[model samples]
Each structure stands twice: as structure tokens, then as C-alpha cells.
Target: MRNKKTPKIFLASFFLFSFLPLMVFADSQAESRKFFIDSSYDVANREQILATNKKVSSKAYFYVENDWFNKLEDEDKITVEQTLNSLAQEFDEVIYPRLTEAFGPEWRPGIDNDYRITVLFHQMKEGYQGYFNNGNEYLKIQNPISNEREMVYLNTDALFSKNINSYLAHEFVHLITFNQKERLRGVIEEVWLNEARADYAPTLLGYDDEFQDSNLQQRAKTFLSHQNDSLTEWLGEEKDYGVVNIFTHYLVDHYGLRILADSLKSSKVGIPSINESLKKAGFSEDFSQIFDNWLIAVYLEDCSLNEKYCYKSPNLKKLKISPSLIFLPSTLKTQFSLNYSTTFWAGNWYRIVGQEGKLEVKFEGVPDVQFKVIYVLCQNHQECSVDLMPLDNSQKGNLSLDDFGKEWTSLTLIPSLQGKVSGFDGRENYFPFSITASITRENQEQEIIAQLRAEIAQLKA
Candidate 1:
């Protein structure tokens, strides 16, 4: 074979281009480390930054990086100072007023205490928002990184008043909830409830940002389709924490923010505490029913129907439907399976049509795992009412429906991971499962009673 020698220029170009991505990858990876949530150097071990930098107080709070502040130009320094002061003002003016108005004066902290929010200005990752340690009493923020200026010389845009204020407002709620003057409970509140309240905090404080709106819409569109996913499994993630926000926002929208604050003060934990707050807010439905309704409202985002419950983004996108059920007679058990399985924070939405006959729906052959199934009277696609059940360790719930009548063309069934995820990382390739749904005649009693009542009325007439 003739020897075909490669050009020296081609060899050099190939070598350089091949490693270019790796070099870029390395730089990007290094940059990402800066924005870890609640960056590693918090008050618990801020000694490294504190060793040389004096803890200086801005008009609002204590910051441990005087050296970083001194490096700022005079104009930038004033902006930083005023921004910190504004955070304080937001807490006192916005956060406090909302809490007091929602709750009562008695629940408000009598006087500000030794603890104050501390600002940590560092280069956080691309999506790295600030983090809060109610345990540490600090609200850490990342110094914006821009090609226009160094991190220390970031301009007013880097200050991100709305963003920073929202962070402060949200974290401050967590701090206040943990260290409530009345001290209703010593233990930390449930994770979902805690974050739900935190998410609601920013909105009530008037610092509502696009982040919350966009995230809420995304989650609603994502989870509403799979209402059965575990609402409790948010560990080392951001969006799961945001799902809890919808719940709290719903509470505030219907009940008011006081219920959430009061939830912190009460010994009741998780759903029970939320239920108590709901009762206090004069809501008739308990958390379970409320959650069920929330599922339906999320799918059918019609504000006019009072189904308009969640903090939807302005666009009010529609919920994606999945795994529709096959209509079957109420005499035999019919199995309808999911066409495609979903992964973490994702789910399958189903619908089964029925006649006025009493309809019974059940799930079976389901693997022993944590998951949620929402049953809703979905006669019209636009009008839906949701019901939730957990099928765990070979558990399933049966539903009987004759009251909805034939107007209910179909029922919405959503089977999803309740987010009770364990054993595998969230990104496992999803596989379809043999989940069965069946319909059967409800007992004759419901109809018999109706006939009996009708007969008695007719006889009297």
C-alpha cells in the first residue's frame, strides 16, 4: 500500500481542536464550584475569610469581608452599603409588615436580637442563588461575575436589588420561623412546609421575582401531570423545594400567610400542621382534599372557575397528558398500562371514561415502591377535581363514583413517584411498569337509596 503521510498542519490542528473542548470543560467546571448552595465558608467555618477581614456592619447587617468591600471603588462601595441597608429595610418594612398583617402583633418578634444576616460575596456558579443557614444566621450571596468587571468591581447590576431582597426576605422567614420569639416548637419544621413558607415569603414581602414565577409554572406543568409523585422527597435539590412553594402559596392565597407562620409556631408537623393552619384559616377542606383539588386545578388552569389556585406564570401553560386509560365496562377488571415510564420529578397522567354506572377504579401488579395516584372526575378536560392515594409496598386505593354521572366522560389518573426516591440516583433510565386499573359496579345501595327516597316522595305527593 502506498504510504499517505498526513500534513504536519493537519496533525497540529487536530490535536489543538481535540483538547479545546477539554480545556473549556475544565474552565467551566472550575467556575461551577464557586456557586455551590450555601458555599462552604459560612459562619460555622468562616474563620478563613474572617482571619484577615474585619466584620464590618453596613446600615442593615454585619459582613465579614471588609477587605472585599475596601477593594470596591467608592461608587460601588456605596451601592453595596445601600443595598445591604435596603435588605434590612425590606425585612423590617416589607417582611415584617406582611407577617404582622397576616398573623397578629403577638406573633411578631418584640425586638431585633443579636443575630443579623451576613452577606458573603463570592463567585457563585451560573445558577447559584444565595443560600441561608437559619442555624448560622447568615444570608450568603455571590458576587456577580461579568467580563465587564472583576467580581470585586461588579456594578449596580451585580447588586440585583430585587434578587437580593427576595433572597433576604425568603431566608429571613426561615430564620424567624426557627427562632420565633414565642418559640412554638423547638424542632425544625417539615422540609416541604419549611421551604413552602420560604417560597411564599418573597412574594408576600413584595420582592417576588421571575425565578419563582417561572419555576412554579414549570413544576406545575411538570408535576401536575404526575400528581402522584412524592411531595416529601426534596433532598439536595432546588425544584422539589419549589413544589412545596405551590402548596404554601395556595395556603396564603386562600388562608393568608399567617397560617404558614403559625405552622412554624405549632407543634404539629408536616401535613397535620398545615391542616391545623387551614382550619384556622377557616378552610373547610383538610390538607388531603385540598391537595386533591390542587392537583385538578394545576391541570386545568382556569382562574374563572376558582380552579385558578396556583401562582401560574403569565402564559398559563397547559399540563401535558400521558398514558390515557381504555374505557371498559364496570363488570370486569381491565388493565391499562403506561406507554412510557417517567423518571424522578416526572410522571404519567391517565384518563378512563365511564357511563353513569357506579365506577370503581383500582391499581394492581404495581411494584412495591413509593408513588402517588391522583383520581379526578374529569368529565370535561377543562373542569377537573382531583383525589390522591399512595400505593406503597403493594398497596392500592379503590374509588367508587356514581355521583359524578355520565357528564364525566372520563376520569384522570396520574401515577407518579411520590418522590420517595431511594436506592438509585434520580437519573435512572425509566422503564415501563405493569400497573393495572379496573372498573366494577358499585353496590346497589346508592341506587336503592335514591329509588327509596324517590318512592317515598312520590307516595306523599
Candidate 2:
């Protein structure tokens, strides 16, 4: 189900700041204090200075930009205060405990030496819901621009929205990820997997159980529009979130939360981390094999065919890909060919409506690149069957179906690049491939002979 109007997409930023020496603030119940803000999104000004008034809670501190707070009406200000207080309670009771239990903890006794996390609310650039900066976890001597605390920055505009809690859960995961993977393990987690965990945080916290207007619902809509986006590439775009959110949902739905938790705790990064976790869990399927199953699952989300072919989550039970390209074979046009390229782990679907004849398909791809070709054969009012089209050393494969038109009502070809297991640097590598299909009718012998005779008689005359 697609929303008619644009959704308030929750976008969070994870940025690393350079270490620089700066004055640090001591723990206090101060009325106001100056803080460093990231102004990279602001084109007109690049100043990183702001003053905020603090609201203290048992487990956290909420700071709102003084200028923005001053402009709001008295009643609106009261509402903002209530929202922050509620968020503080939720964080202490829900987000902190749940995430820490699952993926480990944020740097404990952090830079501030207090068990309190800081939440800063300011007018950020449009489209940004919030962000978590690891710089805040370092001392002033290590990072000059550091706030020397476990802090998260939220856009002032989101302070009043119901989705603010979800934003907090998302950013808080990044803080924990920084500690779990980078601080403890001394390795940077891949951006895609990092974001995937954050995107799944809402679901883990039961925020997405409502489905409507939930982050998961919005991501589902975004994914339907941009299904071709690569799962491993991290461009920090909305489409990137869509891909990671849904893919992560599918992963956790089947493999359980241990996949995420164990992978984060592992010393390895990205694909290797996930593979290591899978091996430890005693699952025979590796990352590549799971990816292939996921490709089919996205197309035909029917668990009846195979448990791996569908999402067990009720929210995503109906989610499936609708191929944009469709081929119709007829006597006038008996052959069709398509040439295109795709990034690694991207899903491409092509549907073919066969005519009454034998349908033949040949797929050719770059020899150096690994390709996985899967075809789903569906007959009217019958269960569909899925199988792989085996490619030889040359990365070429052929498929022939004699009952394509009569027995099989439709055929969908899903092709993906399974190469490049690790080290995805947000670069787009397009692997070009082509698929050619032709149909041969059973009664064509007499017609060809008569046509040839007519052509020969005419040529003699």
C-alpha cells in the first residue's frame, strides 16, 4: 500500500569529526551553555556555534536551541518540554536497555563521566531527523571539537512529532555501534550494515508494530519505488535507507536477532562479520546464498513454496517486487532482446508472457563477474516453481521450455551480481548483461515451404 502524500521520512546522519583541541564543559545544572553543531548542511553559513537551555532528567539531559525555544509560543514550549520529558523516560526504560542488551553498550562512564546521555535539539537542515556523532565520546584532548559526552543531535523540527522516539532509537544504535565495533573491536563497521541495524532498531523496540505511518511502512513504500538500489552501497540517500531497512527486516525475520548481535560483536566487518556469525549459528547458508534466496523472496513472497521465499513478519507478508519490464511474444514479433547493467547485489526482474510455442532464453554476462540467474515459472491458478539457471565458466546460460505458452502462464527472470563479497566503498560497478528470447511454433514447416516457393517463383519471373 502506497501513501498518496509524501511521508515525513526520518533521516539520520552518522558522521566522524576530526580531532581538535577545544574547551570542555563540566557537568552542571547550568541554565545555558554553548555547544558545537555541525553546519555542513547549511550553505549560507558554516558556523558551528549555538547556545542551548538544558532540561535535566535522571538518565539524560535534553538541550534545546535557545533561539528556537524563544520563538515558540508559551503553550508550544510547554508541549516541547513534555515531549522531551517523555522521551527521556522512554530512552531510560526502553531504548537504552533494549539496544544495550542486543548489540552491547555505548562507551560506558563515557567522556562526561556521568551515566547520562545528552540530547541536543536544534534547527538542522531540512530532511534530517537527527544524527549521532562519535566525536562526543572522546575527551577534549583527543577531539578538539568534541563535546566530551555521549550525545545525539535532533532536528528542532522533529521535537514535536510522534516519530521523535523512533529517531532517538535510530541514533542511539549508532552510538552503541561506534562502541561495539570501532571502540572495543578497533574496526569500523561497514556503513550499510551499521545503518541496517539502526533501521531495524525501531522494529526491535516494537515501534513498527503499528505498521501505519511507521518507519517500516515508509521504508516499504520507498523500496517499492527503488527496488534496484544495491543493498551494500551506502550513499546516505533515502533509497539507501529503503534498501537497508527492508533487507535487514527480511534477514532478521528468518535468521533471528543473533545474526545482527553476533555480527556486531565479531571482530570482522561487513560481509565477513555476517558470514562469521552465520557459521557460528550453525547455518549452512552464507551471505551470498542468503542474498540469492532474498532475491527470490522479494519477487515471489510465498512461504508455501519455500520458507526462505517469504517474510514471516506479518507487516511484510505481502511485500513483493513487481517487474517493470514485461515481454509479450507473438507471431509478428517472435524474438526479443535486452541489454543492461546492474550493481552488485541489485535485483532486476523481467517478466515474459509466452505465446503458444517453445520459448528459449539465452543470458550472457561479463565473464569476470559472477552472475546468478533465477527464473520463476507460474501457471494460472497453480503454485509457481523457482529454480536457478546454471551458468558455465563463460558466465552464459540457456533455458528452453516447451510448455511455456500452454502450461506456464508467465515466466519471470531475476538476475543479480553475486561478486565482491566485501569492501564495498559506495562505488557503483555496473556489470553489463544481455538476455535474448525467441519462440518457435509447432506448425511453421508448411508455411515456410509455401513462402519459400512463392519467393523463388517471383524471383524467376
Candidate 3:
């Protein structure tokens, strides 16, 4: 996916998945099954693992690398199969008990023993190692090519306090959150809350002291510190260990896990579906409000210098006065750049162009003020120049010099398709607009909070 420019903000690359080649599957059942079995052994080990907790699918397939086969002894080959079976059962034991408790007894074990997880140990180039979607299954590759090996290395030196368990808890939650019927996977927002709720499952299962560790909270702390400018982009893979884990931690700490889990029971699976789950929670307040509250608290606490994880200062926070500040028509057509000017710093805006009908801005700043009042200045129907408006006498809609004097304020202005013009014809892809927000200090400019940018990518027919 390509990124568009907006405002005077700093640009960052958003990384999630590593691009890889697609693996084709055999149509013949016997061949597929043979592939699965051989893949699980070493030269010293052989034999297909027979699962105990769940019935093994008669047609399940296993895949193995030729190199492991070259080194294993005949006896060790048997051990490999036994090990696979043991790992499956052990994984289930560690996982199901927690899932069943959180999701309720009705939640059944893996649907259709037909689902299979492929194991691999390849000398991959120095980089990430983990599972990726492979057709109907997941490929768990062990990359020997990694230099850091922090995530993929199977090491005896690794620590396993409750904090680490939360990591495991989070990933396991992802596994459980999968819908076998639709073949859904990963931590999309709707499912994110589920995993977030599960993040506390370790504590519920009796691991409290570790939950209190300063190191454990690093995940949430990192996200809380950077919410404003780069979360969507900053939350790339390398930083996920903390961001995802911490979001999960926050979910449980503020909203009880049971409430969070109950919220997820009926929740949808992707970003948009998150609202469905939030609705199930029956909290009259919107999820954004709740998120803002949690975000504000986190940012303020994490910004402390004494804290292990401190957010760098000198960040620009942008707040939008409207759904979007419309820019003059751009038939330059293919691309547009967005920029923001703040007394504190110069920020950039994200370009809103294309058939994807929506614009989004993430307003980020230190938390201190109780509320914000916004003003959108634009020519009646045409785009108008927005003079930085002051926050004083905002209830009266007036501005003065006091507002432009501060140095730490930033507003991330975003736009969503509006009016009858939302998405009609090819025009539905975009609405031309340029916009920016003026920051005001309600209390003292201490809290740093960021409003996430969202563009409605789905179009109605």
C-alpha cells in the first residue's frame, strides 16, 4: 500500500506484513497428507504427530524441509513426531483453558480437525520469522537467517514472567479469535479488543505480581507516548511487541476483562466491525470517547522522564475543527500534499485523494485540558484560508493573538466524505480539501493525546 502526503507533518513508513511468494497446494489428498507428515520430522525423527486433545483430521497435511531430513537420525525422527503431537496438546492446554474461561463454555475447540498449522525451519535471510497465511492454513517458518533473533530464536536464556505470558496470551488470543468458518486471521480492531481483553487473561489465571512489573507495561506505555503523529504508521511490526501488548493491557486495566471479553463475543472481526462489538457492550458512550479517555491518561503518565519509556518531546499535535477542511479542487488529480503549522512545531497533513471517499486527521497534544472547542473556516462552498483561531472565547467563535503564541500545540485535521457529494460517480473516490487546526492550552499544555486518522475506504453501492 502507498502513502499519500498531508500537511507539514513528519512522514513515516507503516510496516506490517513482509511480502512473500504464495505457495501452491496439491489437489491430491494423499500427496497433501504425505507432504504434511514428512515436513514435521528431522533426520533423527519421523512419523506424523497424533494430537490428543482434538481429533486429528484424516486429510490433514504436513510440510517439511529437505535439509532437516538430511540430518536427523532414525530414532530422532520418531522423537520429532512425538514432539509435534506433544506441542499441539500442550498448546491447546495452555490456550483453551484461558479461552473457554474468557469466551464462555459454549466456545468449542478447533473446528474441523481439517485445519492444519505447517511447521518450517528455513535459513531465511536476516529478518522476521513467524506464521503467514498459506492458502487454507498458516505457515510457521523458523528463519535461521535472522541476526537479532529476539522474536524467533528458541533460546534457553529467555525470561518468562507474567509480562511475557501476556505476549503469549495476546498471540494465543489471536489464534482463538480466528473464525474457522471464514478463515479470518490476525489482530484487526474488532478482534483487537478481543486480544486486548485476553491480554489480562494471564492475571485472571493467577499471575498478578508479574502483571504489575514496570517492564510489562512498556507495550501500552510506548503507544500512549506516540498516539498523536505515528501510531497508525508507528505501529509497524518492529514496535508491535509493545503497542499491541500495551493496548491489550489498557483494555483490561480500565475496562474489566470480562466486560471487554463480553464486548468481543458479538464483535466483528475487522476495523469497522469494532463498533459492532462496542455496541454489544451496551455502553451508551462511543468507543472513541472511551479510547480518548484511556489515551489521554496513558500519554500523560508515559511522558514522565523518570519512566523507562519516555516519548520524545517536540512533537506536533493537530486537531480538526470539522470532519475535514476542504481544499480547493485539485485536478492535478493523482496526488496532493497536506501540511500543518503550529507554534510548537511544523506538522504535515495526509493527502486525501482517489476513489476512497474519506479524509482523516489525528490531533495529538499533551493532555491537560478538559474539553476542546473547534472552528472550521472555509468559504461558503469553496475552500477558504484558515487563519489560526485562538481558543479564548471559543464559545463566542472569535480569535486573537494569545492562541498563536504557544509552542507545543498541534492539530491533525482529517476529512470524511460529507454532504450529498460523498461518493457519487468517479467523484466518489475523493473530495478536494485543505485543512489545519489551531491548538489552545486549556490547562497548561501537559497532556499529549493524538486523534487517529480514519478514511472510509468502503464505498456504498
Candidate 4:
């Protein structure tokens, strides 16, 4: 949802692709490693520089950009220098080994004299930047700066921010992405893809598991609260960017890192990349098919590739409702009485097909004896989440005999819906699913049967 309080700026709606030159530029032409200090960098900036140095110096092969050492006043310079030295010692002692373990020997210092990368401390818009060349790259950062005061603005004041580590860890993913460049070039534009991938890295690395977990809950709320006039309105939206992290984490957990690495290096396909990424992830369904499901789950349509659940469509069938299935629509009007026998029990799967519509279900008997009809509906493959959980509260399917207490139990699973809507336990849509019912009473046994039938009347209606 757009922040009504934040002044609306002319935000660009188009996605910009970073064109990696066919030939890597020579070192002389690459962006120079120069720092432009100003009032903006301030004391906070200097402190962060020293802090980052202490966090990275253990390997000792890399050195701080000490060119401007003498440029500052004697007093200011000494304090900065001392801080830097202290930070260097900390990195050598505490941080380097851990980083080595996380990235492996390939990231070990002095292992590659040909490529020496460096991280630069600078004021950015409250995030970190890691851009790579044939040789090395730099990391630009800002805590969270905003023109107006706000709690989470990424600027100088944000150094002590709760998610500082999250931002840093995210850029660390870019370092990982750099190492996997060959695998990413084919599936997405280099810049957008890398940023999106990095956005999810912190969660993958478990930098802030608890914080990320909480953020995922917030994402569902954000997705459902607003209505954008067009998909364009939702572009570059950041309220639930952390949700991308959760989703990317899900991918790495399920499909392995290779799929993500491959997607990053893949070529750009503009809007179609949404579908291309799904296909790469082994989804054969059309974009609309998956998006429609997402719309139902989150109450907002996600136009990004990462939001897709990455599943294959199930085997589909269309059965016309014969005279036998709907022989007596009026017969189903009465409440559960002597005529209502359990012909279909919970767990019996069925499908309701209609013109431009479909539904699937397992029979869930009426909870209230006063009610006349009950059926579980699984509308599409998106809601067919039995694999994630045996009973999905979010799924909609056809009426079946097998959906009594067991199916209702599935509705009580963890991660209940919060904020605006209730009982929306997961990230799927909520639409009332309809089904036809029938019954017959005989010998004191109410033989109640519900058929998986398509609406043939749509042909005649």
C-alpha cells in the first residue's frame, strides 16, 4: 500500500535493464574507487567505515582506502584512523573466519591476487550497494535517509537501525550472486534480477530469522490492504519486499540454489520473464493461471516472478452433469433429515465444471445440523496446497464426502490471517465456492451423494 503520509514523488514505473557490455571494460575505464566526503557523510559515516573495516580485515590481503588519510584535520583524522585500525583488528579476529566459512575457500583472501574487491562506506538511500566488475567492486551504504522524519528511513541516523544487519547481509548475497554471474545472465536483466535476488539473501543466510519471520506476516497484510489501479501502480512497491526474501528462501530450501543462480544469469524477457521464471522453476501453467491463484491467496496480485509457488498443474478432467447427478435439484433443499444419508464421506474428491469456471472438493459435512448443504471447494491448482499442508484452509474445491472433521482440522493450522481480514490463514484468495447437492432416504439410511459434475445447463441456459 502506498504511504499516504509520504509525499508522492514522480516514481518511475518502468523497469530498467542493466546492459552488461559484450566486452568487459578495461580496468582503466571502470568506475574509480574514489570517496567524496561531505557534511552528509558526517561522524556517523566515519564510524560505520571503521565498523565495517573491523568486520572484514582478518584475511589482511585487502587494505582500507587510505588515500585521504592526511586530508582531514589532525584531530579528526586521528580519531578516524584509530577507529579504522580497531575495526581492522576486529575483522581479522572475529568476522573473517565466519565469512570464509560461509562463502568457502573461493572467497578466501589472497587466493586470487588477480581480483581484489573492496567495500566502500558512503551515504546511499539507506541500503547497501555491491556492484562487481571483472576485478572487484565496492559497497555503498546509508542507514536510511528521508527528506522527512520517519522511523525506518534509510539514512545517516539509521546506523543503529534494527535491520542494519539485514541490509548488509542482503548485499553479501550480491557477492554470492557475483560468483554466480554465469548462471544469472540468461534469466533476468542483470541489475533488477540481482537486486531482487539480494533482497531475499538475508533470509536465506538466516541473518535475522525472527525478524524475517515477523515480516512475512506483515507481507500478507500489505498485499491485501490496497487496490492499485493498474499493475503498473504496484511496480517497485516495497512494503513487503521482505516477503520476497521469505519466498526466495523457500525456493532455495526446496529447489536448491542452482535454480536461483540460473534465474539471475538468465536473459531478460521484460514482463514475460514472470512466466519464464516459473517455467524455469518447472511450472507449466500460464501466467494468468498462477496469478489468479495468487490474487486469491494474498488479496493482491503479485506481478513478480518470486511470488510464484513453482508447482506443476495437476491432471485436469471435465465431466458434464448428467441427469442422474442433478436429477432432483429440489431434493437437496431440506436440512439434514432422514433423507440425508452419508453416501459420500469426507475425503471423496470431486470436481464441478462449468462454462469458464471450475471447482474441486472433498466432501465436508455440514457442521451445523440446521444447515442444508456443505462442500469443500478447491478452485484451482494454486489453492491445491495439500502438499504444503494436508488440510489447507485457503484451498477451495468441490463438494466431497471426505471433508468432515479432518478437513476442518486443517483449517486450524498455524499462521492465521491477521490485520484486515480474518480466517484467511494463508496467502491465498477467499471466494465462496458453490456446488450442487442431492439426497435420497431409504430404510432409515439417508443415502446422500454429491457428484463431481460440470454445469451442462450453461450450454442450455
What are the lDDT figures for the candidates, one per model?
Answer: 0.48, 0.80, 0.31, 0.31
Best by TM-score: 2
Error of 3 at 212 (Å): 10
Better of 1 and 3 by TM-score: 1
What TM-score does model 3 achieve against the real structure? 0.41
Q: What TM-score would you give candidate 2 relative to the actual structure? A: 0.90
The prediction achieving the highest lDDT against the true structure is 2
Error of 2 at 199 (Å): 0.7
Assess the local accuracy of residue 46 in candidate 2 as a C-alpha lDDT between 0 and 100.
43
Summarize candidate 4's per-residue lDDT along 249-363 as a digit string, tens digits.
4344434555555554445432344446667878666444432333222321222323443322110001111111212222333222111122110001222322211112332
lDDT, candidate 1, equals 0.48
Predicted candidate 3 versus true structure: per-residue lDDT over 1-461, tens digit per residue: 00011112111111211322334332232232222222211233343222111123222222334454346687865665565454446435664466656754311212222223322332222222222221212212322111111111111111112243333344344444443212222222332333344445554555444433533444444444433322222212334334444544444454455555554444344323434555655655444444433333332333332221122211211111122223323122323344332211001222222222122222332222212323232222133222222333211122332322122122223222111211111111222223332223343223222211112223321
Worst 10 residues of 3 by lDDT: 148-157
**Candidate 2 error regions (>4 Å):** 1-30, 42-45, 445-461
Q: lDDT by residue for model 1 over 221-314, one digit each (tens)?
A: 5444445444554443544654566555655665666677666667776667767877887778876555555555555555655644443534
Per-model TM-score, in order, reads 0.57, 0.90, 0.41, 0.37
Write down the lDDT that model 3 would get: 0.31
